[model samples]
Target: MSFLKKIQQPKFLPNFLKVAIPFFVLVTIFSLAINSWSDIFAGDFAKVAEANFNNGKWKAFFGYKIVFSAIYGLYITNKNMK
Candidate 1:
């Protein structure tokens, strides 16, 4: 059917959303579960985050996502090329 064919087409936003939305949900759940918002308001989490930022943990944290996106993009590009 046309609907099935349409659904089968490779769409980046849907694929990324499948991963990203769930990731965001999980992070939110984890944050709430750990009650880390209290630490945020108390200034403890900010201090830790600041220390991590100064020490380059922010790079490590965000860099992995960048690397992953690059790799995934490459994979998609190669697949499309083929």
Candidate 2:
């Protein structure tokens, strides 16, 4: 068999992940939506975490979570490519 034919038959994991990863993400979001959608859509500006970190300073944990989650999502996508 030729090299190209060999590569085409027993495929690599990246090829599987190319489809599986995105589908996993969509399912995760759907699950989260179904679980805490009430709290999400209700616009609950509640203190979900402790803010006080140091001298006269407050950390916006909720905002931090949102930003971190976005970064993590991107990281997961890039990880699969490699």
Instruction: Identify the candidate with maximal lDDT.
Output: 1
Give candidate 2's error at residue 75 in angstroms. 25
Question: What's model 1's overall lDDT?
Answer: 0.54
Shift in Å, residue 51, candidate 2: 20
Clashing pairs in 1: none
TM-score of 2: 0.39
Using TM-score as the measure, which candidate wins? 2
**Per-model TM values vs. the true structure:** 0.37, 0.39
Tell me the tens digit of each residue's lDDT in model 2 across 1-82.
4434433544434554555556556655664456456655775424211122233333442245445555554455444442
Q: What is the lDDT of candidate 2?
A: 0.46
lDDT of 1 by residue, 1-82 (tens): 3434443657744655555555545654464435455666677866656644557766765565556655555445344431
Q: Please give the CA lDDT of all the candidate structures.
A: 0.54, 0.46
